[model samples]
Target chain A: MTNKRVYNFSAGPSQLPLEVLETARDQMLNYEGSGMSVMEMSHRSSTYQKIFDDTKATLKRLMNIPDNYKILFLHGGATQQFGAVALNLMDKGRADYVVTGNFSKKAAQEAAKFGDVHIAYDGKDNNYTHIPTQDELDIRDDIDYVHICQNNTIYGTEWNYVPDTKGAPLVADMSSDILSRPVDVSRYGVIYAGAQKNMGIAGLGVVIIREDLIKPHKENIQVLAEYDTMADKDSMYNTPPAYAIYVLGLVLKWVEKQGGLEEMEKRNIKKAALLQDYLDQSDFYIYETEKGSRSRMNVAFKTPNKDLDAKFVKESIEAGMTNLKGHRAVGGIRASIYNAMPYEGVEYLLQFMKKFEEENR
Target chain B: MTNKRVYNFSAGPSQLPLEVLETARDQMLNYEGSGMSVMEMSHRSSTYQKIFDDTKATLKRLMNIPDNYKILFLHGGATQQFGAVALNLMDKGRADYVVTGNFSKKAAQEAAKFGDVHIAYDGKDNNYTHIPTQDELDIRDDIDYVHICQNNTIYGTEWNYVPDTKGAPLVADMSSDILSRPVDVSRYGVIYAGAQKNMGIAGLGVVIIREDLIKPHKENIQVLAEYDTMADKDSMYNTPPAYAIYVLGLVLKWVEKQGGLEEMEKRNIKKAALLQDYLDQSDFYIYETEKGSRSRMNVAFKTPNKDLDAKFVKESIEAGMTNLKGHRAVGGIRASIYNAMPYEGVEYLLQFMKKFEEENR
Candidate 1:
């Protein structure tokens, strides 16, 4: 933790482990003495092939993915998957979506283009204040799949436990909280994440789906937009985001070194608890979401007054804590403590918050 | 040229300037004195916003793209555009495709799934030996657009001049040849290139489309698949590939410092002429394409036997010249001299080929 440097709270496209960034920088020009940048190497070359294989294997190991699942490294963020999911799976049948936040609602709307989309649960009525309770969910028996967002970055709410779909295929957009905890891969039919918040960079998305879920549609779909074609080609039908994949490999290795997902979950909880405990004790600041549903990664909070919230954000930036401002849609302050954020960063923030409270109060 | 360290001849996802790599490496830990990697900075941050703005501006200057043309930095490679173009423009009627190489054929095949697709001209019957002659073109005035691959990386062929489309909009997949030379920007409706070849890395695709071409679609389309939404949002409706865009800016700067597109065209011509002249003069090896239609970037040639082609590829790898093997469809040796390849690399390859020919003969 002593080696930990700056505290970055920017929400997606956030911090990567220092060690991973250092290793990638060293290998940028010459990857493993191949005398070519990973970007310059052919995807089929033994060097790049090994990197690709090892990266996928590492991700599988970290997540405890089943042998029946195929891990795909694809281009276009999770937004593209909204369309891909519709094209591949909808089949003009009914699909249910639990809209906990902005992303899930967007996904539901996109998926609606292909089939009958039912909003089984929506947190928008409550300003996305809490995760949908299991009893609140309205699963349709005729539905093809159930889609949900596991974590909401904008509102700082996360599902505390996976919903039991009673044998319905579960598909989750775990973009913001994927590697931060342990997940049972066998329980879900599909898990997709944009590699920005807890994974690697902004451009690539990681999709881990059951092989059986990608059956070809009866209605002809565009070949490139079909999941089966992409899965069959191992996501190499077209040129992939090679550099992002390479960096993601480094990040997976870093996660393994940090004692894998269980350890990551423990450390993340400790860090979140440190800040949440401080916020709970202080009447000077208010946690934005309900206590039970607060996100471990992104902590959204506000001061008693709007002017003070602005001042806190401004003074925090001046204090070397940048990007602490919240989403424009819900403005206050959001401190995103992603995988790379050390415990000290959170401690520093809590201390500053306490001092600022005393000074302003 | 003496100051140049080594010449790189990779086809796509090829070499980047050493200075750019060095600067990026130095800034991998921190960008613009910010205490975070560019990979870690949020897309919404002013720090990253500047980087994004500068990248778009540099690309515009390098291409002399008109203000009326909206430049979009997208993901999923040029392959995505095969579907995206169909989704955007194929509503009125069919599209005319000129199949000059593998990429154009794939584009046509993908578009066929969406709407009526007609192959106006195909060079496959001639083993892609030459670009189509003006008289051979099947121009259809009623077509929505004309699609052509400006340069065929696999077959080592390039269109020397834009096809005369009397009324229909001209669209080009310039994945292999963009920014290698100047073009009449006003003549084309859209010019898209995958960044791997001449722009930057594999993750980003640069699309320069006329603004009018992005008019709202009358039919239902996935929001993510809509060009108008992407253009209206400045390519940020979803998270983009940030590091790839950063590298593109560096390449754009390098192009500008080298006297822009006019100077680059002269350099490219000289490099192509040096190697093609050697291939023409030598009786021991045969050039794969016709004399007039040879590619200025990828130079494919063949010996009389398959074993010799394998030997050349193996020997060249040992000599620090890599990826010289041609596409498996074309069983021969190909030397891809993209913009990053210094003139001396071509000289080295010629020298090696001459020696190999003498020994084998």
Candidate 2:
């Protein structure tokens, strides 16, 4: 209905690259002469298998994933995987968690159901605005794995460096920031991301796990929860989110065309800096999180006046800038600048911010 | 790719209504003036909530779902629900299963992992050619629930009537046959289907559970498996398969435009009958399933000789009639004609069958 496109800044199911959406739109009915939508194609079909294979390969290329690592396109969001991660990895009946924000807290809570989960570090005293230093972590080698959420979507904090797991395997929930930067695949045992942020649509979770980690756990009741079963089937143990995977393939292709992860990181840094730099200079606004730990994906800030913050959000929407309101968990204003968010969108927000601040002040 | 849309008839992840696909393509980038792809919109957004609400309402209307029945858009596919169903319903630690075909047998097998599962009736000994009569099912009030797969997609048989559970609630897996017909919602405790078959696409499973069946069992650990928790969140317990649910909405709208489920059933029956009538008249094609139990959604058959079956499958694909090969479990051919398959597609296959049979015979 609206002719003009808005700059979407919500976390998780946030903005996607327009080019990727266009590609998906073009292939909606007939995918590469298959004469069907990806949703309509059988997972067993060669057409879909190619889509599946190419997607995995593209992801591998973008992330520089090692051959020892298997990329799985599993059906279910990150929350479902919280249980699966524990069921599969917590073979010792104990795991350590570094709680950075909401997602890490949920991961720890879900893991508690399957194993003896220990919070190695908690940032709650700082309101999850900073990642803990290695000295602060009491990671035990006896624990099966050390879990952390690399980027906190809600709190606008990120671990700039991979935490030292003290010989325990590291598992990260990279849900909100998977392809936003380059990562050393060899550094972690498992990296899982729900495909709603900086990936594709919702529903599918991409779990990139080292082959050695896929284990046979007799304690696990559900067959789908068994990582070995899914790994062997190439995540086709059952029907997958075919269309989501296909769209993800398109997004991956888009990422590769945008010069892969290095280029993505560079662009992300620039985008984040453009907004963060402005906020730093504006006495009227505040970016409370530690500057070193600030996320390049999401920037949360607050105006000195609550009424101005409300007015800013309202007026921004009218000017076709949407989802600028911060999450209710920690609210003021948050602008998520995912890879898909163009520089021009940030400028659009900047223009509104300047005009709104001047008029309101 | 191809200008002419080839008829897609693979099992699940099968054909979607063209109207739904067209509507989706049209709105792929901008959804209803929101100025963002539905895929890009957050699950927490008011726009997506409206989509979620309207979709559930449309489904309730099409299915004539009772007020007490809560429809859920769950993350995992039907296979995932197999464990959830057993975990939730098998409160007494035992359940009875009527194994009609592959899916039902799998369900029974999975339920065994959670609790005691007894297969009261099995059709596989007879090549899954017929549904057992009510007397054949050893239904008892002692069991927690009686389970049935209403339609056998692979074996080409269907339960013509709901079996009396003898006071215990009935659970039905209607994956391949949902929306192909209508049923009284009050008869079953839980009815779930993977979206790929008669619904829109893969990744999401739609579960309609009666409120009273949402139990209070402390033993069930995974909060995602808890139906009440998901139903309470409106399937936003975490970010759902948002795009898949959006497509489901478009599909429901298409079904409504086609005069609702009654009209859908009528069209499906007519389409099924066209292929069935032709097969019955042809001596070369073997319709093995008992006529009384034949499915109006899937038609499975074979030629007199295995070599002829091979030839027909190979030549048919060249002629654009694909996925006709039988499941490896059953060596023959299967044509799944869900609600999306147009009458013309079946007629096209009929023409091929007529010509192929005449020439081969």
Candidate 3:
């Protein structure tokens, strides 16, 4: 095994806390003297039940979730929730979606399959570089819920202000930026995230929803996709992603020890500012995202030309950083500095960028 | 951290090989000099892609899967596949289900939500103690597909012979007995199993389907649940359960080194026979499953009385064998000796059983 740990910056399924990995390794053979790895234990077993309960509890504590909200540890990632959200909450057979970037566009498309999906705001014309202002959103009052992706991993744009849905339930896909900042859990009817980015690892989806919103859907949706079924069974409808939830619990504990979401937001802001400041001044680089819409989690930028961008990605990997390549949909560079990404990693990237700019010019 | 590892007898999310766990622990911090844990890598990167490709390749090699079939590593367990099976394959809006045990019953119930599910054979009256004979299964000629749970973890029954479905395609949920022995992939239209049992861990479902059967469904189903969508995307439809797939690859490699399916069948038969033989001779305990229907994976048995059964379950844990308690649906003792369960583990359980029998008697 290599002693080196590179700064990984590919959107979701990205970097996890080193402490969590260490703890997981230490208990790989046996968990808490239980004689089986977390992976090997039955989800129904008391030992694994504790891990499941503690993970849900810690996330609730960190987010200050209301008593009316229930946390579900599910199998599929946020992509699965794109359909589940619409299937479960489209009680009126209609919903509104704010299409800010790639993921939101996909979510709207999936939701359209289940019911009448109205695109309240479309950012396609602006190349997904801008999050729509509340005034620009054409949310329908009769819709069941208003859907929005809180942060766009591909476009590097995040909704700076929560849209007023005029009393309608707000469902947000916070896959890339959930735990990186403090969230008003009461504001949204549901908030779901994939556990590969700000949490711990892949294989798990964390969904927090207001208890009242989790009623039986009118359609014949899959039982596993029904929020009420999961809530009623306490997310043990079937065997969960046991090991991923255990690791997520470890990561949550680490976040708690590091003073929780407020502290995470502080660090994330600083890290983003360091890179944003450099990109703003660099003559050879271009940060396309609108100033007000820039995301603190995923910082997307690129060199003046495609060849230089390719060279930058290659040289960055050689300089002990990898996965800085932008998403295939939008080719350039994207440095995803999630909660687990150290401030030093972004500083290192900035230093490399400075060197590259000087050499390229 | 404890140095001692106990024998875990969980049905699914069951025991994994000790060697696989060691390899995982050794490379927890750095996976093959990639400078990141497998959990931290991007699913799109070359490093992570290699892991994904290698895993699919190893499983295909071990199973001797045909070129006419495609393997998909998906989220959610076999529970999700229950609905996906009908939603994707119920082109005629009708299907036949063989309800042999608890899981098959659940699968049928889920499928009913999507289509007209006909129970061709049900062993409920037999207390799930027998698998239906081929002559007993009344598969309809007009049905789109016939579904069956090949091995029942809760009931400890297995279908020893595949039923002919006339011209209709066959779909088998091999969640419990997959990889325990050789499987003729061409016999079934689809064979899907949750990775927690004989494979590796929870959070992943391995779907093996004939290319011809993966056609577009008539109904509006979630894209993630569509077999054709997954087959088209090469199972990278969205971020997959990355770490679980990696561990599954390691387990598949271990099975390969142990001489593939023939050797696995030999070891599994030997282990199952040892336990079955002991139960057969013991007057105090009863193995309820019909001899011809007994599974070589999960061996379910009980004492003459409920109190004695509780005592047996309690004493087994004290004897360093855990998860001996049966499913809540059927309260007794269940020792799930999947492929990773060593013969010595069964030996230890037998030793404990013999002592418990003597004391109770």
Candidate 4:
């Protein structure tokens, strides 16, 4: 099969590393000479057990996860986690949320169904273009857990630093920017990422949670929604998404080969800077994101008019660039330079932008 | 990659059709000149939407699903349905369950947490060797739904006929033998199948639910777990398992090419008869299951001793027959020939069993 010639820039369910795709393709039919597609292998089989274990271990090594944290591979994306977190953690009283993006807002709204949810900070006033500063947050001391989205995929913004929640555990939905940079995994109570973006696929979500938070799960929570039961069973309390997990293991191996999180951060920084610099140089297109809070993963921008923006996306697609159409809520072009997007793809975009700017100006 | 010279008979995730694997391999990187892997495409993208629609439509056609039943491609496997079924339907009062295999027992156990659950019948006394007879059942008239496993993969037993549930809705977990035979789908209020068996992969579960059953979602149900909400959104409420769904589409197409479920049933019957005939003819192997209730999907047999059973499994593995080990609870050998297992694979297994019997005798 021929490699994808065009670059994909959709926020999540974005691109994957070429090597990861190649390895996955090579092993599609017979993983490790098992004579079965990874999809066909039993989750309890020794072959899949190794794949599952290695994937989790590699994630731990890459993220420097502490011993107290249990990493779980779960189904139903981060959207499902909204209810799970609320169901599991919001027993004492209320939970605090820092709404930064469309997803975070949805999470906060969903949690409201279970308990009293307080919005500690919200970027809605700024049209979600900026992440809230530390001083702007209004976290409550009595809250169960503080929730936040680490990276705002739609608005082109990300948290530069983790919030200090004092005694309360901090839970972050890092759906887009996970493994793109290194972090102190021990500091956060829970960190979750849908595999579509920095990881591999869309079906599986990985959750790294401190053991203490899961202990409360014994108190009348639904069995299917309980983290403790799922974690204890090694995510095999039920039949898991075996193929997704296999592809994730391959992606993790590829991440390790690419020098882990440090190397990814460096490459991601360079790619973001290259594209942002070109956008800054041209006045024809304006970036919707705040200068200080721009996301390295998703870069949202807009032209002077909607028609122009549509033309830009169309012409860019013709020029071997796809999925640059911005989100509907934020009408513009978003160049999501995820870990898999090669720098050359961004360079091509820059060239196209320069030519378009020269002709329009 | 060299194919492992072994025939896998694990219930599920079971063997995949060789042709499906080949087609998937050929289109892994670029799907239909889209310049993107099916994994990379957006769920809402026209290319992927078509695949999604075609898969659902094909499955409906193959199963004879009525327009009133909405087919949803969901994550979290059938285990999630254990809770979802109760949350969606048990609002009226209680549910009737027939405990047969490990999965059904677990499902009944989970459903008990939500509302009043009545075990209409159980096969545990018979070591799950026989399906619950109509005379043995004690279904409640006030029950919201009657739940059963159509085929118990672990014990190699299948329901020879569907239960007459009077007026109550019939819900069956057809995870093990979903597409292997044609059924009157309109008769059941809900039928769910985890994709690993007759469908495609492990990440997605197909739920064919009657529209009326979904309308009465109780208050305070998690949005993700709410059947009505999911069905309303057409299963794209969140980023789905894109790659898994794509593979399911391929498998559905493969099923169509192989002459649909009617043809599949014919092949399954022939294959199952071959293995069962060999077992019935030999004194060295004892078919523990009742003669009339043997599953076409899984065929379980035992030897005189545990050590002999162990030897049989070991020798079978060496002879390129794999995963023939039965469930740990029932110490024996089980050959699971799902929809993907060709008639020739079962023929080889029967020949091997005959030779082993001769040598052991």
- The sequence of per-residue lDDT tens digits that candidate 4 reaches over residues B1-361 is 3466357788788888888888888777778887888778878788888999998888889888998999998887788888888888986669999998888998898888888999998888888888877888998887899999899988998888989886899999999889889999888999998888888888787899998898756667677778888888899888987888888888989989999999999999999999888788788898978987889999988887788889899998777777889888787889999888888899888888888787886
Alpha carbon deviation, residue A297, candidate 2 (Å): 0.4
Q: Candidate 2 regions off by >4 Å?
A: B217-220
Candidate 4, overall lDDT? 0.85
Q: TM-score of A-chain in each prediction?
A: 0.96, 0.98, 0.98, 0.97
Tens digit per residue, CA lDDT, model 2, B1-361? 4766788878888898988888888888898789998989988888999998999999999999999999999977799889889988877988999999999998998899888888889886798998999888887569889999999989998988988988888999999999888899899999999998888889989999999988874443676787878878888778889988998999899889999888988998899899899888888899988988999989999999899999999988878877889888887888989888999999999899989988999
Residue A237 in candidate 3, Cα distance off native in Å: 0.7
Tell how far residue A274 is off in model 2, in angstroms: 0.9
Q: Cα RMSDs of all predictions?
A: 2.3, 1.2, 1.2, 1.5
Best lDDT among the predictions, by candidate number: 3
TM-score of each: 0.97, 0.98, 0.99, 0.98
Q: What is the C-alpha lDDT of each candidate?
A: 0.86, 0.88, 0.91, 0.85
| DockQ of candidate 3, scored on C-alphas against the true complex (2 decimals) | 0.73
Candidate 1, DockQ to 2 decimals?
0.51
Q: Which pairs clash (backbone N, Cα, C closer than 3 Å) in model 4?
A: none
Between candidates 2 and 3, the one scoring higher on DockQ is: 2
Candidate 4: Cα lDDT at B79:
84
- Rank by DockQ, highest first: 2, 3, 4, 1
